[model samples]
Target: MKFSDIIGHEEVRNEFDGLIKIGKISHAHIICGEDGSGKSFIARELAAKILGKTEIKDYADLIEWKINSGKKSISVDQVRSIIEEVNKKPYEGDKKVIIIHDADYITIQGQNALLKTIEEPPRGVFILLLCETMGRLLDTIRSRCQLHKIKKLPKEEMLAFINRKYGVLEDKEIKSILAFSVGVPGKVEDFMENTALKSIRDEVMDTLVSIKNMDYDNIVKCAQKLTEYKELWREVIECFAVYVRDSLIYKETGKEELIINSDKLEDVKKLAMQFSMNRLNRIFDILNFAKSNMESNVSVELTYGTMLFKIQEV
Candidate 1:
């Protein structure tokens, strides 16, 4: 994908081009943005330009040499391999590109291995580093590179992207997905692909409704049903997040257009009336923790049971 194809971040795109146009492109650049704001996409796009592969191919194709900087650290082994690749010289383009995704995942050793090269980069070698937070990066690494920041797309552009990709969804569906997706396009795609996400969303609302009416047993049943599938538990957490977010928007703007759980706005309104902000925040925190733990192989039963008990307290 080229800069023109990136859906948003006009300013950043222009900055990127200007650097290339002047033939003074930085050897190392740190591209930082929130999750799903397309940091990796932009990195690959820049690499394509450097490698003289401008045509857009399948997303999967661009990931041919992709390496995961495992767990919170980019291995020194990966850094050495990248250095070896660059030493082969530019094959067909003006520059050779090394695009390192998740720069924050690079360990101190990896960063140290990279420092001398970054400080005195070879002619025709361009490095693009992508991260969510520059603060997490070593200052020595940050000092050698230029930083480009991208923001989440505005709602209109985000919705337009969804429409362009998936056509016009039902208004309620659009609101619900957009609100909960936190303006992340990848998450929006995931929401669209999973047909069961909607039903699971309704179940989350139902659980909230049960909480509203003091139907304690239904809350337990809701948790039990969610544990039936790992994916279902994730959906419950996602929808629940959107549900609370919609409540915040409802309390602030009173606009239905911004409500994520549009079909269950009334239920949200009722619960919003009943729950304190602190209560909502606490539940969201717990669910987020559960998601993190689940990713690390926490048992489904344990995750759901803990979540239900916490929600019961609320």
Candidate 2:
């Protein structure tokens, strides 16, 4: 994809284009952003432009590296191979571009292996590192690269893009999708394509509403059901958090417009009555803790079980 094809980040696009026009390309660049925020897309497009090719596949000088499926980290051997490759002259283009997708997956050893190349690359060599967050990378590695932080599209921009691409969706449906997207277009597109995701979201909301009343056996069953969709646990947790937060807001302001789950206004209002402000705050904290723990390699079933029990107590 070309830079023009990217929906947002106009300022960043302009800056890159200006840099290219001025012939002052940096040897190393770190493109950091949330997943589904177009970090990889932008990096590839920039690499293509740097290689003077209209398409990525047509650019013989472009070397792409990504973490293999089911792999926790990109190994040091992979970085070493790229180091060897970069030492050679470009085969078909004036510039050689290396795009490392999910750069955060590069282990400490891998990062150290890449350090010398990044520090003193050959002429016409450019390295683009795409990562979800910069904190995972070594500070020394980060210091050697020009950092570009990409953010998600604003609500209006995202809605416009969704409308243009998906045609007409119900207003409520659009709002629901936006709520789930958390400002990420890739996420919005995923919600659009995966019909089952919406159903699962609804199921999560229903289960959460009834969780406090469930017996121990039923709670275990509920956790088991959640575990079956472990791949979507993050989204489920975020959606549930938003629902609880909106209920609390509605309780305070009595403003239906302020609630994201507008279709479930009555239910939210009833649930709001059941939770005092402090109780709702604690539940929100529990959901956020669950998300953090899940990212730290905690067991999904155990995390969900604990979260559910804490919600029941709240």
The most accurate candidate by lDDT is 2
List ranges where model 2 is wrong by over 4 Å: 53-58, 248-258
**lDDT per residue as tens, model 1, 1-314:** 44466788778877777777787678789999977788777777766755556654443223223446345467888788777766665655546777777778777898899888878777878778888899878999999999999788888889888988888678877877776566778778877887677667777777765765556676667667887667566667777787877777777677877765666778879777767778877878888988987878898877877787787687
TM-score of 1: 0.81
Following a full C-alpha superposition, what root-mean-square deviation does model 1 have from the true structure? 3.7
Best by TM-score: 2
TM-scores, all models, native as reference: 0.81, 0.89
Worst 10 residues of 2 by lDDT: 51-60
lDDT of each: 0.74, 0.85
| Model 1 spans with C-alpha error above 4 angstroms | 1-3, 50-65, 68-74, 132-136, 212-220, 228-236, 252-257, 288-292, 295-297
Pairs in clash, predicted candidate 1:
74-105, 176-260
lDDT of 2 at 242: 76
